[model samples]
Target: MYQHEPPTEESPKEYKIKHARIYILLLIGQVLFPNKSGNTIHSKWTQFVVDLEDCGKLSWGFTVLANLYREMCKSVDIKVTEMSGCVLLLQAWAFTRMPIISLVAPLQAPYPYARRWCIKKLDYQNNPRHHLQGYRFRIDHMLQDQFIWRPYLGLAPQRHEDSLIWSSTTYIICFHIVEMHQADRVKLQFGHLQGIPEEPQCLVEHHKMTTIKARQKAYTTLYSDEQNCWLHRELFMLDGD
Candidate 1:
């Protein structure tokens, strides 16, 4: 059995600008090219829309997966025989039973199977296209968790205990194991970058379309190149007048 702290006040209201682009892109893609091309892979735009609509189910699934992960990590202290059982169960959960999807899919707002894309503005000056900084990717991922989906789920804010203890213990242990087996350990070099001061940019301040109809109108008018440029802007640099 898994236990979690009681849900407190509602989470923060957050917006995902990049996802709006994806929604608009899929909308355009469907209108322009409804039929499949020469490639064997078929587009999942319809299913993606359907998945987005299943927000409740997605949220529940996320809760279950979080508990399961917590329980698996807790099993480290059990007897040897029970530990063997835990190992098998962890393997099934982490591998055979579609671990990535089970863990990450619930975090998504509405889409289940959509290919994950990093929508952050890439830094070309410090880290070029060929050699990308791993930390940048990790930061982008962390922001996605903090800003994008977590808020959408309306999860309560984490308590001090949850933040300082349970959350850290469960995730670090479970994910560290996963990375140890599956990931290529890359030592990052952040020598001089540490001294550089942080610059905050307001990228999500786009024209607010409150209503669904208004949003749909805005999406129809939004050009792909414009969206790309807006998404890829340097976070640390302010746009010139």
Candidate 2:
């Protein structure tokens, strides 16, 4: 909390505080509004502060982040629970010739297990662009030296055209991990990804098509197969719990 406003009414601080408070209240309104209909949180926050009369460029960054922090605080429900531990699931996509979807699942031990897979090519093509690629999902956990990217099956699969693999794989892996670890709660977080392509529709079309059923089947099959393989591998590692 940067306090630039003076406590005295005679000071310019009085005017600044009044105006700033008005904008802050509107921001709070947006955050608290159920079914937000306006611009995104970041957009509204930045615009509100920048649009304020006489507000300068230098303080904009700080104010935006700070107000966002305030809103997060307001929204978070501080609850007491019996479970003592929690895990965070971070998902991010990297755009390239063939995009990569990265997932890091939390284990009971001090470190986490990561997985990265390439998205399927939705459009049929004679000359396939890429086969397989290696992507390192780096996490700056605690110390700079303590980063782990293991179960390192580099991005490979490139067949199905629906392009639902990324979201499907994410759900499958997350469900398996949570069930295995029996985590109290999972904090789903997204990374700042850019230039990612839009999600593709179901591959089969024309005859009585339902996206839900097709995606459900794909997710289930993938999860079962992957889970079995993952568990078998884990059993061999003496370090795993």
**Candidate 1: misplaced stretches above 4 Å?**
1-192, 211-220, 223-226, 230-241
What lDDT tens digits, residue by residue, belong to model 2 across residues 1-241? Answer: 3355434656586576665765564544343321233443423334445445544433332223323333333354466222111111112212211122222222222212212222233332322234232233322122423322222233233422222211122211221121122111111111112233345322222112233444555535644654573445323222111
Cα RMSD for candidates in order: 23.8, 21.3
Candidate 2 lDDT (Cα, 0 to 1) = 0.31
Question: Model 2 off-target regions past 4 Å?
Answer: 1-35, 39-58, 78-241
Q: CA shift at 237, candidate 1, in angstroms?
A: 13
> What is residue 54's positional error in candidate 2, in angstroms?
4.7
- C-alpha displacement of 53 in model 1, angstroms? 21
**Model 1, range 73-107, lDDT digits (tens) per residue?**
44655552222112223433322222222223223
For each candidate, what is the lDDT? 0.29, 0.31
